[model samples]
Target: MSIPGEGHEDVRADEQKDGRKAGGYGLHERANPKRHRVIRLWTVVHPSVLGSTTLTATASEAPLTARLYPRNWRGDGVPSFKPSGQKGWPIRGQDLVRLSADYWWVIGVGVVLTLARFSEAFLVLKGRAAGLPLALVPVVMVVMNVVYAATSAPAGALSDRIGRRPVLVAGLAALACADLALALMPGLAGLFVGVSLWGLYMWLTQGLLSALVADTAPEDLRGTAFGIFNLATAAALLAASGIAGLFWDRYGPSSTFLVGAVFAALAAAGLTLRRRQA
Candidate 1:
């Protein structure tokens, strides 16, 4: 009998060992508790780098089957895969037009309203047909602002539920009516009531518009979008208020509300476009 060469047999045995090393381990082998136990406490969390190193067995390609050896000879299994990178983000932009529209439209409306107060101040004085009472007009403004702060968002949600068009139209109409009420109402009490109504309406529409923007804006771009939206509104208000101040002096109380109504009515009607979104 010819004896196998010493070098050839050793080479074959080494090949066998390599092959066995590549072949994967079964769960039973991993779960075997009776054998030596390994408590691998990972000190630093290494992100899972997959794609290249992550190997999957192709049934046909590896006819020369391989086995996975433990990192050490003790046969402790490989650690489970961990996902890398961060989580996903939220919705955004012109696609969220309802939100953007509300932000712009409401801002336009609000800017006009905020600046118009200065105009309303002189008008209220002149409307008194007396040299304006310093206390009365200021008090009206303060109370109106308080009401505005109190009532804004619920009204917006209400508007959202009922339909933006109707609420907007009604707010504009009420705005017009409120001004008329103030223009016509002779007593301080009556003026108070009228101004209060306008503030309440403002609260509703402003909050509603903001909510619309928040709801629509994508998670990442929200701060930028909302900032721009508000800036636009403020700019418009600045123009309106400046021009409106002159108009207040020129045409007096009647012009202020009339102009406000014209703009508001246009905006309210403008909301008809949103019907499709509903």
Candidate 2:
């Protein structure tokens, strides 16, 4: 048999004579025809080798690389696939009801906590009211997010070690304190303190609640549990914001924050009572 690329030189010569260049040796569409053909043939012949090499390199270099490269990595069993039917509203409604009944306290905490915290936009408004410059108002959220990002990992780790309830209680307390500071204290310093506390509250509570939902939910109903929990909390947040806006327009910022503080206190008390009962 003739060598695979033996006629490539003659083909190039013909192309040149016909006023067409043989294109450069690259992997793109305009690459040398013979080299591209050889690459395609090699891939066809050793498809698994090429794919596995790429996968191995990717896994080895990915983040948390040490964990990715397991010493006993193996694929011995065949994966089972099944066609699942869509769940109807009736079935989903029944699940929602069951989840509500079984995990009422978890759902309750989520609702009350959401109600206790309005949109962060209110915080920016509060900062503005406190004499923060229009341009520098964005700094309020920046500081809050910085504290939140800095502490969230540590808070999650602590909750994992100590348990979710106590950590959540502390978070509610932080929220109450934040609301108190925002409502009662004066000036930008107070705004920053409240903002920081708000960040701490978020860092402490948000992840813990998700972990709590996962812990309490049945494996088969985890997705349903999350769906219902999110729905309830979202509704509560909407209502809370509406109420806060009413208070802001009618009474003032202090009343708005004070209302949030009251709700936070009530939620914390409810959680403590629930824990004792449990």
Candidate 3:
């Protein structure tokens, strides 16, 4: 009988053993409890200097799928599928529609108030027209600014306790009185008093408007809300001055002041209506 070659049989047995080791480790760990051995599936092939290929199997506790490709894969070892980097922040049109009614109310009231107030340049001109000495005319602004600086913090604090709407309505009503004082009275005294009242209105409304915007806006979007609020009121104020100037040139300063009074009165009435609705 012809006998099988011993070297060929040994090589075939070794190949079979390596295949079994690879398969068993790929599915689960080894059953040796004492050694705590970890088994992993691998198809390891190495070419030796002798021009022979060798196959080998080994046990390892860690998986190679993620760790082996650090740059190409995610932290968890899976290939990264997310896009790299991010774009800069931008305010979209959807931001306008997302603002609430109360926020819009605050912005609207601010715009109306700004329109009625007009520019302090007109206030200085009114002082001069009321027979104020040219040098003393600037005192009108000084007094108003002093009053504004003093009362601004107090007005904001009072609104925090009593609520923003009441304070804003009161300020608008005071603004109406100031406008009427400037229109109807005929002396330096009227200019001073009207300008003082103007300062009072600034104290009452400006900081409070900021607070209302903060209260109504989402925390993340508060800055954007304030920017919108300021922009709307600023544009209104510019338009209002142009309109007031037209009235002043055609009908006189009294007509301009009278119109401002009317606007302030209307704003107050609207605020009252909104409060009732709320």
Residue pairs clashing, model 3:
66-77
Instruction: For each candidate in the order shown, give its overall lDDT on alpha carbons.
Output: 0.58, 0.84, 0.81
lDDT of 2 by residue, 5-89 (tens): 6687787767676653334333354556777788888878797888898888876442442345443233432223334667666
lDDT of 3 by residue, 1-278 (tens): 33367687778778889999998865554455334332111213222422342122323322464565466676554577575454676566788777889889878877887789898899988988888889887898899999899878677678878988899888998899999989998887788788889999888887777888998898758878988988898899999999899999999998999999998988888789878998
Looking at model 3, which ten-residue stretch has the lowest summed lDDT? Answer: 38-47
lDDT by residue (tens digit), candidate 1, 150-214: 87647747775886557766766677667666666666655777778778667655555555556
Between the candidate structures 1 and 3, which one is better when assessed by lDDT?
A: 3
Tell me the RMSD of model 3 versus the true structure.
Answer: 29.1
Model 2: how far residue 12 lies from native, Å: 52
Clashes (backbone N, CA, C under 3 Å), per candidate, total: 11, 0, 1
